[model samples]
Target: MTRRILLFGATGYTGGLVARALLERGEVPVLVGRDRAALDRRAAEIRPSDPPYTMVLDVHDVGTLRRTISADDVIVTTVGPFHSHGRTVAEAAAEAGASYIDSAGEPPFIRWTFEKLGTRAANRGARILPGFGNEYVTGQLAGAWALERAAEMGVPHRLEIGYFSTGGSLCSLSRGTIASLAGSSLERSYTYRNGIRAERPGARSSSFRIGGRKYSGFSIGTTEHLTLPEVSPSLQELDVYLGWFGKASPLLATASLAGPLIRRLPGAKRVVSTVGARLGGFGKDGPESHERDRSGVLVSARVFSKSKHKLSEITLAGPNGYELTASLMAWAATVESHASTRSVHRRTGVLGAIQAYGLGVVRDTCLHLDVREVESAVVSA
Candidate 1:
């Protein structure tokens, strides 16, 4: 059986970008989505050399989805707010023993993908990798590098990662991204403090200095909290923060302080979700191409020894999040599609980029995407 790549949600903003990136690499993925007209429009827009093939399938139809996948196929999905719509597609991929990748940033959904679906996928020979996009992959790569350098310390370490956007704003976010954030705000998040523990988004606030300027970020759950420990057992605590709010970082932290109390109120979660959705105006599209071109991404990772001394710090600078996400997802899908015939053995399970492709491959791929190491420093004993 010839292995193929299938892209689900091919008509959405991020999905279309992924399709274009794949086409640029000479691999035309079979576009899969429920909207035939939209898929046709997307295919027309990209204009691949060969007439692109498309399949109309509702993600809710689990049985049909499972039946449509093959053991040797690769599935890349961008249909998200994943806590609600992702399980079916992920489960189907796992059941069919197909390699799966998704543009998921929701912390709860990511955890579920690892803890719940991981065993099943591994048992079925499926390599499931969620949060493959800008949401966490860059941080994962930086953290992996820092951990590698910190290994010689021979003591438990704490990892701190901060995500910052130098030229983007909330206006640049897509409707799907807005909805995901709104829905995720009402869900429980976690952090790794010796072990996984429940935590609220924005519960903690910290800062990072880039280009000699300090920027504040609020804590949020990210896949790094779950995958970094597996990379190095000496990891004792992990914290991931997002500085997109810029100066409003402290305000978000103050609001999060009320999360525990608000969550206990009758119907508070529903009310908040409803208000957020309305405020986001889900029907609108994301920023225009020029706006995206104006944006850039920065991810920083710091490792600290148990004795309260900083071991090393690494920072990566990259293209806009959406653009980088498209390239990253396309690269991951291509790698997975060829894994069976490659010399290196591919592990089947929920994995980070380093676990799936190794550090050198990830570094090279990021470099190709213009995501490079902008800063690095190691402290001596």
Candidate 2:
């Protein structure tokens, strides 16, 4: 049973890592991207026991890409600016009945995926699993853990899961993700309450401290805002806090308030990218820098119930955001390649990573790859 994987964006930082992971794991993926020289170079560098194939294909050509994909194959894509390049890949994978997975974090891109390709993919028995990367996987896992504790205690009304990262994000954090913050006023912050979504904008704010520094936080972004409701019906309030600790936290928070306005202006990416590029990089010295680029998620959740079981805080951290993302994507592809998870085929509606992959599987993958999980318990008042 030869499972041919069609990997788009193989030339990218994360994509290259994904390709390497697949080859190293004994899965021969047909790496596809626009760069032949880069792909060839990467293929030469990969120390696979055997060998992997590389192809020069533009995902924008949905027809050709789909025709090339087969039912037995799986598609792992890491190309972002997903708003510009993801749908075609998903559509092709769905039409060909190939299982599709990608690392998409922007809310709009995902919203479009659900609206346009979700049903088609499901109907064809092809699973379109999004956010298999960093955004919601860890947070969703934390949500599941909170719900389990809530059910055990009884009267589980709300769960607050805050994600604090002292990490360097991949260059994939596109203008859209930043722009999503601008639209924070579009809807009130929401969390699931007894299997229903409840909105609470006032509860969304900043000024949280993690890793010995104060970082600014905000209510924008759809990961916790959207996925928590489905992962845990008992959670009425889900607030995802990013960059909530550090001397620069307040500035980041203030910028979040102006995200919409700032993004509206021209040259936004140019300005941001130039400044970010000039920052050179977070060196190996700072702990926060260690946390960021190394790929670590700090999940501090407070579960409310009778006797309030303030469960242990958990942190999943690893080496390099892009590399971890690629590894995770590769792992997801391997899992989907096997028809063993037949239940995933029957899953029709839009699904989150935790629901689709399971917490233990995700947790273990993170761990096997040196993703550190730190835990601490707190007593209820």
Best by TM-score: 1
After superposing candidate 1 on the true structure, give the runs of residues whose Cα lies further than 4 Å from its correct spot. 152-156, 261-283, 341-344, 376-381
State each model's CA lDDT, in order: 0.84, 0.60
Q: Write the per-residue lDDT of candidate 2 for residues 1-381, one digit (tens) a residue.
A: 546788888776567667878876768788788888978876776754444688998989867887788778888987765655788888887787777888876556665666577677777777777777656666666666666656665755556666555444433343333433333322234433443243432234554344444445554344555565665555555555555233454554554455455666777745654454333223211123234354444555555653555543344444554456667888878877766425544554356676566767766777787665553322110
Q: Give residue 381's lDDT in candidate 1 (0 to 100).
A: 8
How close to the true structure is residue 228 of candidate 2, measured as C-alpha lDDT?
Answer: 59
* lDDT tens digits, residue span 255-294, model 1: 8777777888898766776666555524555667888899
What lDDT, from 0 to 1, does candidate 2 have?
Answer: 0.60
C-alpha lDDT of candidate 1 relative to the true structure: 0.84
Candidate 2 lands at a TM-score of 0.76
- Clash number by candidate, in order: 0, 13
Clashing pairs in 1: none
